[model samples]
Target: MCDHHHLRSPAPVGIVDHVSSLSENFAELVETEDYADITFIVDGARFRSHKVILAARSEFFRALLYGGMKESQPGTTEIELQDTPSVAFSALLKYIYTGRMNLVEIQEENLLDILSLSHRFGFVELESSISDYLKAILNIRNVCHIYDLANIYSLTSLCNVCKDYMDRHAQEVLTCDSFLSLSQTSMRDLIARDSFCAPEIEIFRAVSNWAEHNKGQDPTPILEVVRLQLMGMHELLHVVRDTGLVSSDAILDAIRIQTESRDMDLKYRGYQVLEENIATTRLGASVIRGEMKTALLDGDTQNYDLDRGFTRHPIDDNSGHGIVIKLGKPYIINTVKLLLWDKDMRSYSYYIEVSMDDKDYERVIDHTGYLCRSWQKLHFPARVVRYVKVVGTHNTVNRVFHLVSFECFFTTRLFHLDRGLVVPTENVATDKNSALVIEGVSRTRNALINGNTHNYDWDSGYTCHQLGSGAICIQLAQPYVLSTMRLLLWDCDDRSYNFYIEVSTDQQKWVLVVDRRQESCKSWQTFAFDPLPVTFIRIVGTHNTANEVFHCVHFESPADTSVGSLINSVATVSVTSGPPNSPRPAQAQQGPAYPLITVDRGPSLSRSSSSSTSSRSESHQSVATATRVHFPQYYGPPPPPPSAQQQQQPLLPQPPPPQGLPSLHLGHYAGHMLQQQDVPEADRMDIH
Candidate 1:
């Protein structure tokens, strides 16, 4: 009453006067509760007045306060409100000033003092903010309390978030006593949900290492955790196979958990699980039968004579060609085993025979022995034979050569070998030069023969021609050191002739390496020559009147020289380093040929003379003297005349004689040894 009129002097009649005037007018307009069409100015914009009024509600105010406070200072503690009674007022003020609620501050125990205020005052935003902030900070140590709170409040998202965080940092948080006390369901849920995210190998290693260290400790908890997380029995077995973590105690604990659980579905799964997890070991068994494909029955009960034993089954009578085993094909036979039942009375022999094209037969294995009273395993190296037949030669009076069991095993995993050389069956044709169409052999005319004459026609289609009492020769384009030679004749047998091999660095100089006459005229056989290096090779047929009608020719490196050189060189070097009494290493030491050297020296020097006079005289002397003294004489064998049967065939066109060219002989001639005339004048250089 004292000067109240002065305080309300026309509402101060300035900017405040206008504001007050507008407020009064708004109050009058809203007095009828008719807020139908009204406008109000807020922060720089005009809005419906009803909207502004609705925004002042407790819920909206709370949201505004929280948003504003978060924007102002992210990740900082929010301001605390007073008592529950003042919470609404605080929320209202925050909404009016910042349009958001700051209820995240309620995470503090002290802030919980006003939690009910937000719930009762219709501040839903503020309530939710409090729950979210709690979830972000909850951990294993406080998880129990948080869980109870979440359950009471029905906060499912918050509960899941807390569980997830605890599981991710389990090693760090599980040390807490409270975490260990979690209900089994809670622990199971946590592990099952998070296991997929765990590093599988690392977890396995850690669990294994932990169980190994704590051998005698109770493993129930660890086992329960793993059982809940393991997806299947196969997964468990894989883990065990790789990590070897599940100890006996751990396995028992897992079994107990499964038994106690009401999950009947896991029973069958568990049985298979344990069976697959058992450790496994491996053993191997094999059989051998030389080149034969037949299995051994029993040699223990009967005495057998291998050479005298022969079994014959005609191709027409052999109904089980499909069942018959093959050597070096479907299976390889290397060793044979025979089971013996009695020793004193049983003696037997075994024999194997193979036929070419089911016609002519050859024996591969022939052995005679008495059966001992023990199971015997025998080894046999593969020989060159095809069709195989096994027979028992002798039988005891009581036991009649009975066989218990038989099996054939192979060691050659890949590739199959035929009876003879494997060559294409078709595509054979004579060349324009009249050379015979040897199915798989290739030759060029650039090779040398007996003399400096390049008149050899490798492509000539001639089958067998009579040379005027001279040797039949063929040459190669490049010189090759051959150790073995095999020839297949078309109409004549290779074994009928006395054959000799001659090689020459220069066609004029020949060295005979093999001089042997055949006693039998077999269809095919290999002739091994002493290993030597030469440019030209000539085959001279000395005996038997049959013309040479070769259809196939093959050359191979010498086994003794080629393989021996490598092993011998190593042996020699080793022997040189040891004492002289050390058995001389059992082999000669050979090495690669000497390397060529280039120099600007003026004149050409003969290698023979220089090497003899050089510091390596001892080494050169042995090689040189051996070459000179051991040289074999070369006399071209008299050629065979055309047989009467060959003359009966119709005559064919004859090919022209092969052309001749100046032969170039470059043997052991080093580049540095050549004279200026040998090389072009433009390429010469002077020594310093």
Candidate 2:
């Protein structure tokens, strides 16, 4: 039929590229006076333009050119635009006609002017395009200026983009010359943002420099926006006290807030949500060669190279010497992560101090009373810091404190799983092997809380107890508002177990939070419930399909998988002091139950009938040969407790240093005592 139809088909319609030609025709009219019906005189430069074209392209111009305005009158031809730049007007006119702007041809400095015209003329598309272009081109050199212009123009989206850029580069932005040149209003706005990442001290320093640049400008208003309470006592007393920008009463109030209040938010500075490490050499950070004998900023947390870590010694606990890390610039930080020399079970006691200037330091952590091993994640009140000094007060194995790696950063991560100590019930007896005591506590280095799920086999990677005999428990360092938990049940084979979880503030009153006794479970399990202050958690297994023992490989609170798995034990802490008592079970609403989930079976490692005994013997020899750990032993009498009068007196002021050197005063920091509470003797161990 097609052959018979040999009729001529309509000529194929060719697609012509018409848009560019149309754009060119309009572009040609942009600078011409031909058919001109109106004239725009911007900054004394006259632009002969067509009224109909302007009316069609811009709502603002549509009203001004065709509406009942003086310029729209028949007798009116020339219209003067006030406060408008001629170059921007020309660029705007071209865009209006051609609908195209070659950003590569335009100077970055002039883009803001064009953007302003786009906003003023109600060119929504042009405004958006210009904003996007500006965002892509933003850099340390121009972001601050662009932010100011965006704020002035009330460009909400652009302003937020600029703010984000500034936050990520806060240290650089604060130190830039453009930052000092910003107007007082803009300066206050910039520093007041809760998302701003610089520390309070750095903010104060930058603003002070800004104030100096703009002489006669009162700094009180700008300084008021800084979170003074977030500053360490050293910065508060040495750096801010003399500024006179803030009143003495305000400074005292900030000191009171810092010392007496435990409001996490109040002590929190901006950048708490970022996960960037400011202590790495990649970020321009370095350990002071004179203070640290080796490099600890390399981020190598696994290697046991003796020459890779820093070491310091002390004749006694009061020695103030330690390794110091200097950031490339001042950064706001709240967390310090370091690897202890854990080739052995040896434990160490340490404290951390931070300083704006190296001369003045404020203690942020005081773990000298307890034992710590392997990975140590210490959190303190957020502060601006340039130097971090970690001083070891005691090392259970030797006179020297060895640290393998160190990292410092601001983290929005809410869970502090490392602070808890695993407390397996007496039924799950502690493996007496000294190798298992990587920290000061036995079984603290086991698989349950070590964060590793792949390295252990049937004989090791898991902690277990005979079903119905005893339970496994965890005692948090202190009561924390908890609502969720994540755990991995041993699942190298097609086996399932039944278990229940309970939480308690005191060992005498356990509240049932999770009851999986009726449901079979395997692999990773996440449990969530209403948040309550919890100090203890117990998991009791009721049944096991494959064997008489209940095995677990991992556990974490506020379930997060992004937390990097560590090659250590469950808890990194040990209880030197606590009470011993079993809590009677209490009735409570069961946490949300999870449905039974089938886990894919991996190749099973052969089980040993005497796995516990064999694991202990093997671990003992392996650990002893690789590392050494020990129980903490106090060589001297404990320090005297603060007197009631000493506790009542909140401030510890020191004399100002000579010259412009920083004052060594710590203000109320030293007097702000940690409220030591009694620890229950139930199951005391460390979390890995």
RMSD over all Cα atoms, model 1: 32.3
What TM-score would you give candidate 2 relative to the actual structure?
0.53
Return the TM-score for each candidate structure: 0.19, 0.53
Stretches of model 1 off by over 4 angstroms after superposition: 1-107, 111-122, 135-144, 177-253, 256-688
Question: Residue-wise lDDT of candidate 1 within 1-688, one digit each (tens)?
Answer: 1242345646533545444344444444343435533333323333332434444565443453444645224443233333433434434333433344455543454344333444545666766776677776676567655654554455687766776565556555444555444444454455444222344334444445545555665444654555432344455556654555456555545556655653322211010111110111111121232222123322222443432221222222333221122333111243333343232334344444443233344454443332222233333443222234444444433423433333333233232222211121211111211111111111222121111111222222112211223343443322334555443222111113345657664456788875644432222234555555443455554443222222222222222232221111100111122322232222322321122222121111112211111221111111211111110111123224335574343222223211111011110011101122332333222111
For model 1, state the Cα shift of residue 683 in Å.
53
Residue 178 deviation, candidate 1, in Å? 4.9
Please write out the lDDT profile of model 2 over residues 84-160, one tens digit for every residue: 98988888889989898887788877888888888888888888888888889899999988899888888888898
Cα-based lDDT for every prediction: 0.35, 0.63
**Quality of model 1 by C-alpha lDDT:** 0.35
Q: Which candidate is the best by TM-score?
A: 2
